[model samples]
Every structure is written in C-alpha cells, then in structure tokens.
Target: MLKKDIHPEYGPCQVACACGNRFETRSTLKEIKVAVCSSCHPFYTGKRGAVVIEAGRVEKFQRKYAGTRFGKPAQETEEKEQG
Candidate 1:
C-alpha cells in the first residue's frame, strides 16, 4: 500500500545530453541535463576515445613551467645555460 498524496509528481520529462541528444521520459524532474547518455556513450557508440574539453589551463601550466628544477621557469635556465 502507498499513500496517494505523499509521493512526488512524476510526469513526462525532457532529457538533454551534451552531445546534442534529447529524449523524453517519465521522471520526477521536468528537465534533466546530462554529460553523457546512451545515444552518445562510448560503449554504445563503439568509440574508443573519451571526449575531453580543455580550457587552456594545461597549456598555460606547461608554458609557465616548460623546463626547470621543480618548475622555476624556462628563461632562467636558458640564461644559466648561456652564461
């Protein structure tokens, strides 16, 4: 037995995936956003590589510390080498 009024409302919901896949299903939430879904999942799609979105932080870090002892900057080492 279940209470009639205690349960949250469940109805048709729209699910959006980052890969531009959208589908309708019943859920407690009216809308759902997901990073990956069955339509674009690697296992389902048979893709071997994972999707990665970089925001330049890795490039910035490497540029900021290219070659040094524990990352002291590349210019100082270059100057030391030349001197």
Candidate 2:
C-alpha cells in the first residue's frame, strides 16, 4: 500500500560540494554543477617526481682507499707480509 499524502517531502533532491563531488540522496531538487574536480589532484595528475644520485660517492671512496689494506683478504696480506 503506497500512500502519496503520507510520503516525506524533502526539497532540493540533489547536493553538490565545492570540490566537484556530487551525490544524490532523495533530495526534492536537482543539482547540475560542481566547482573543483579531482582531475587536478596530485595523485591523479601523475606529476609527482623524485630522483637522487650520489655524486662521486663510490668514486670518492675508491680514490681515497685505492690500494689500501681495507678490503684485502687476510691470506693475500699475510703472503705480502711474508714476501
């Protein structure tokens, strides 16, 4: 049994946010336009960029300890010492 007179009467059937987010929830009216759109979001825009390169870090380390006893094996150093 559907009663027309007993039904709720809500005005402005549609609601829209300034962020371009639109939704409908049984409003008595209808909205058609929104302001801001998610198309320009940082995540959606794919514009985030980050790059890093350690300039001369490896080269500096190598140059500073080119032929030193830092990483030489124990047997090689022992042979050199014996020789």
Q: Count the backbone clashes (under 3 Å) in each candidate.
A: 0, 4
* Tens digit of per-residue lDDT, candidate 2, span 1-83: 87788866765556564555566666545554544334433456565531213235677887889787666788888888899
- Model 1, position 62, has a per-residue lDDT of 75
Candidate 1, residue 62: Cα displacement in angstroms equals: 15
Candidate 1 wrong stretches, greater than 4 Å:
50-83
The global Cα lDDT (0 to 1) of model 2 is 0.58
In candidate 1, what are the lDDT values of residues 1-83, reduced to their tens digit?
A: 98889999999999998889899999999999988888877788898565733335667887887765545667887789899
- TM-score per model over all chains: 0.59, 0.30
Candidate 2 — which residues are off by over 4 angstroms?
Answer: 1-52
At residue 28, what lDDT does model 1 achieve?
98
* Pairs of residues clashing in candidate 2: 12-29, 13-27, 13-28, 13-29
Model 1 misses residue 7 by how many Å? 0.6
